[model samples]
Target: MRLPRSRRRSETRDVASDKSEATSQTSLPGDQQAAGAARRFLRTALAQWSDSGLPEAARLGERLLDDSTLLVSELVTNAVVHAGTTVELVCRLDTRESPPGLVVEVSDHHPTRALRDDSGVLDESDVPDDSREGGRGLQLVAALSDAWGISYRRDRKTVWCRFDLPAGDGATPLLSLRGEPPAELIAPVPPQADRANDQEWAGRGALSFLAEASDLLAGQLDEDNVASLAAQLLVPRIADWCAVWVYPAGAGARLPSVWHVEERRIDGLRSVLEKSPPAADKRPGARHIAWPATPGDTVGGGALAVPLLVTGRCQGTLLLGRAGPLGLPDEVTGLVEDFARRVALAMGAARQYARQAMISTVLQRGLLPPAVGRIPGIDHAVVYEPLAGDWVGGDFYDLFPAGDGRWCFALGDVCGNGPEAASLAGVARPVLRLLAREGYGVCDVLDRLNKALADEAAAALTGGTAAWEGGQARFLSLLYGEITPYAPERGAHCTLASAGHPLPLVLGSDGRVREAASPQILLGISETAQYTSESFDLSSGDSLLCVTDGVTERRRGQRQFDDDDGLATVFGDCTGLGAAGIAERIRHAVHAYDSAPPADDLAVLVLQAR
Candidate 1:
C-alpha cells in the first residue's frame, strides 16, 4: 500500500525587503504523487526564502515549515483525488512584516466540482461533515492555515492558504485556522498560466533515486512487490503514471500493477490498460505507444512502453504515461528504460529464488521417510521441524527397520544451511541405512557413513578449492543407534553413539536423568575419525531421548536451552509420560523459551520400552 497522505497547504504570494514578490511555481502531473511533488516544490521555496535574508526571514521555524508542507500536501492531494487534472502550485513569502507571512495556492482543472460526503463526495461549504473521507485532506488544510478559502474561476479552482511565519525560536502561530478568507480575497482573481516543470535526472539526484530503488527492490522475494515499487518510483518523477504487467510462464495469466498520480483515477487507468495490453515487443529500449484516454480524462494521456527483459527473454512490459500532445522526452525514455532493466533484474532474482525454494521443498519430502516404522517392543514418537525459510534444512531424522529383529534410528545435523548442507545430510542418511541393513553395528554404521560423507566432500573440493572454506564443508554431527528386544519381560537392548551431537538422555521411572553416550568428534571432519558404541539396557518404564543440536542449542537472548543441562532436566521430569507426550512436552518447552520462532532446525526422537 502507498504511504498515508501528509497534511499540507496551498501556494500563493511572498514579499521581500525590496517589496518585490518572491514566488516559486511549478506544474504537477495530477497523478497520485502530485501531493508529494507539491510538497517538494514548497520545501524548495521555503528554503530559498529563508536564505534570501529579507526582514524577519531568519525566523522561519520548524512548525511553520511543517504546517506549510502539510497544508500543500493536503490541498494538492484533494486536487489530484477529485479534480484528476494538472495541478498548479505557487509558494510566496511576504517578508516585509515583523514575522513574514507565506501565501500558498493550488489550482486544478475542475472548477465547478463540489465536494460530497463519505461515499466520496466533496462538501460545498467550508465546514465538512465529520465523516467525509474525500474532504479530510481539505479539512486538514483548513486546520493548519491561518486563513484559507477557495477561489473559483470559470476555468480553474484554487485553494489558497496563508501562514504567519513563526520565529526561529519556535513561537506559536499568531492566529488559528479561521474558516474562510476575507470576502474580497474569496472573489476570483485573474487566472494563471501553467508553469513548465523542469526535470533533471542526470546527477546525484538520479543516482540516489536508482540507489533507493535498488535497495527496496532487491529485498522483495515476491515479483508483485517488485512491480508495485517500480510503479511508485516512476510516478511524478519521470512519468505521471506507470503500469508493470507481468506474465507468468506457461500460465498465460497477466498480472498488471498500476499506479497514478491521482489515487481516484487508479481504477479507471487499470481498467483501461488491462483491456488493451501492449504488444509482446522484445525489442530493447523504449518507444511511444498509443494509449486511449479514459472517461473524463484531462491530462497525461501520452504513453511510452518498454519491455521487461530478463536475461534474454521478454517477460512483460513497463508502460509510463504523461501529459502534453508530444510524448516523453528522449532522456526520460532512456532513464525509464534503465529503471525498467533494474526492475526486470529484480523480478528475475525473485522468480529464481522461488523456484529454488519450491525445488527444495519437493526434494525435502522425498529425502525423508514417509512415516517412521513401528518397532514391536518399543513405543516411539518423533518431532521434526526445519528452519522456516529453509525448505531443506540441516536437521533430519529417521526410524526404520534394519531387517531381522533389529531397528535403526538416526538424527543428524550437517555443518551449515542451504542446499550444500542439505545435500550432505541427504547422502549421510542413506549410507547409514545401507550399513545398518548389512548387519553393521552402531559404531560401524557411523564409521561407514562418515567415510561416504568425506568422499563426497573431497569430490566437491577437488572440483573447486576456492569455495571449500565458504561454508561448503560436509562435516556432520549425528546420534545413531540400534535396538533389539532380547527379553519380553525385561527392556530392549540399546546400542548408540554420539558423534559430536547432543548426548542422548535416558530417563528412569523415578525421574532421574543421565547421559546415555559419550561425545565423539563430528563425522566427515576426517575419514580417519573413529567411533565407539555405548550398549545399555532399558527396563520397563524407561525412556531414551535422541536430539540434534538444534534442540540443545536453542537460544533465548544469550542463554541456550541446554546451557546448564536444560534438556536433561526437562527429560527427567517426563518420567511417567508416554513417548508421544514426552515429545510434545519438550517441543512446547523449546518453542516457549522465546517469543520468536526457533532460529535453527530442530528434531526430537523418543523411544520408551513397552
Candidate 2:
C-alpha cells in the first residue's frame, strides 16, 4: 500500500501539468489512527480541489469521491499495519489536457517489503496469504483505479495509482492513466495466421464480454430484468440461444426469459428449457449437458447448464446453446462458469433485498391504524406518508370509540426507524387503546404507555426474554385526546394532552388558527413523567389538526415545508373546506413544497365538527 518517496514524487511530477495542476501532501504516523487521518485529509483535498475552479473535480462526480476516499483508507491502513513506519501521502489533480485525471501516491520507508509480480506490477497473487484478515488493499486498488504499480528504492518503496476523469461530454473515456497512450494509438493488428491467434483472440473477447456483463448486472436490482439481461447478453455473443430458469420459493423452476439469434427458434428453445430436468447433480455450480435435439432441428451444438446458487442453494439455472458442430473449449466453459457465478451473486442479493422490503411493508401496514368508523357529529380524515427507504418509520395514528359518549384518538412518533421503531409503535398503540377502552382519561392512558415502554426497555436491557433480547430502548412523542358531542349546544367537548409531540392546530370558523395544548416530556424517559389534559370546545365549522414532526420538519434542499407559524397560516387559509378537503390540501401542499421524497414519515389527522 505504501510507495517509495523518490518514485512517488517522480510519478506525480510526470502527471502534474504546470498550466492547471494542484497538489496536496500530508504525513501520518504508522499507527491505527492513520487511516482515519488519511480519509479526513482526502476529504479536505477533494473539497479544496472542487473549489479551486477545476472542472475535473466536478466531472469526477460523487462516485469517484466515494471510491477515492475508500482507496485512501485501505492504502493508509495497509501501510500502517504492514510497513510499520511513518507514511507520506500525496494527491494531485491535473486538468490542462482535454480530459482530466488524478494521481494518489503513498510512500513508506520499507523497501524490502514491496509487493510485486514477476513482471514488477502489483498483482492480487502477490499478497502472500488469502486466509489472512487484511490483505485485499492492492486488489481493491487494481479494481478501482485505471492503473496501479509499485516502485522500490534502496531505502523506501511507493505504491501509486491513477484514475481518468470522466469526459465532460458524457462519453465513456478510456482507462489510460499517466505515461499510458490512448488505446487507438496502440491498437494491435490481427495476425495473418488466423488459426494460431484464434484461441487467444477469442479468450480476450470473452473476458471483455464478461466485464461488460458485470457492469450491466451491477446497475440493476430487479430479478426479471437481471435474468433477461443475462439471457440477452449470452445470445449473439457466446451462444446462438440462451434461456434463464428461475426457481421461486418452494416451487419448481420456471423459465423467466429466453433469447435466440433467430426469431423462429425462440419458441422451440423455450419449450426445450421448460421440459428440461434439473441438473443431474441437483446441487450448486456449473456443468455441460447434451442438447435434447429434436429430429427436425437445424442447430447442431451441445448445451451448457450453469446453476445460480446462493448460499449453497440452487436458486435458478442459466442455459446457453451453440449452433456450431464442435463443443466449447475447456477454457471457454470455465469462463462461462465464472459468468454464472457473478449472475448468481447478483440475483441472490436482489432477492434478499426484495424479501426485506416486503417484510418492512407488511410490518408497516400491521402497525398502522384501521379506517375510522362513522362517528356522530364529526367529520374526520387522515393521511400517512412513509419515507422512501427500506425500513418502516415510527409515525402512527388511530381513532376509535373509547366508551359511551366519548371517542379516543392518538398520533405519535417513535424515535428511530426500521423494525425496532415499528415494534415500539406496535406496543404503544394497542396498549393505549386498551387502557382508554377501560375508561382511562387521556393523561392516564399516556402514563400507562410510558410505564409499558419503560418496562420493555428494562426487559431488553436485562435480556429477560427472547422477544426482548435484541430490542432497542425507544421513546415516543405522543398526542392523545378524546371528544364528546354537546348535543344541546351543537358543538363538541375535546380533551387533549401533548407529550413532547407537536401541538395540535385548531382552525376556527372565522379563519384563525391556534395551538390546542402546551408540551410535556416525551414517553419512556422517566417513571415520574406527569401529563395533564387541556380542555377545549370545537364549535360548528371548527377543525382540529394533529400531526407528527414529519410534517413540520420536511426538507427540500435548504428549506422546510413549513414551520409552526407557516402551518398555522396554511390552516387559516382552508377556512371553508371540509375535513377531507382540508387534509388533501395540506398533503398536496407538502408534496409540492418538495418534489423530492420526504426523509421522514408524515402523518396528519383532521377532525371537523358539524
Name the Cα RMSD for model 1: 17.3
RMSD of each: 17.3, 9.8
lDDT, candidate 1, 513-572, per-residue tens: 988999898887778888999999998879999988778888999999998889988888
Minimal lDDT window, size 10, model 1: 181-190
Instruction: After superposing candidate 2 on the true structure, give the runs of residues whose Cα lies further than 4 Å from its correct spot.
Output: 1-12, 18-208, 279-285, 294-299, 461-472, 557-559
Residue-level lDDT of model 2, residues 1-610, one tens digit each, is 2233233311213322233477899999998667656766766776676667665666655446546666776677677777889999988875654446677778888766544566654444555343554334576666667656666676777777776677663221222211111221121222223224335434444443454456567656788878988877666545667888888787776778888876687887777667765642347556777775633476557788888877787778888876544356676777778888888888887887889888988998888888778788888999988777747878889998977989888999988777888887888889888999899998888888888777766676577553242354488999999999777338799999999898999999999888999989989877777789999999988999998988888787877766537777788889999999999988887777777877788899999998
Q: What is the TM-score of each predicted model, taking all chains together?
A: 0.63, 0.71
Instruction: State, as a TM-score between 0 and 1, how close model 1 is to the true structure.
Output: 0.63
Candidate of highest TM-score: 2
Clashing pairs in 2: 2-159, 3-106, 3-107, 3-157, 3-158, 3-159, 4-157, 4-158
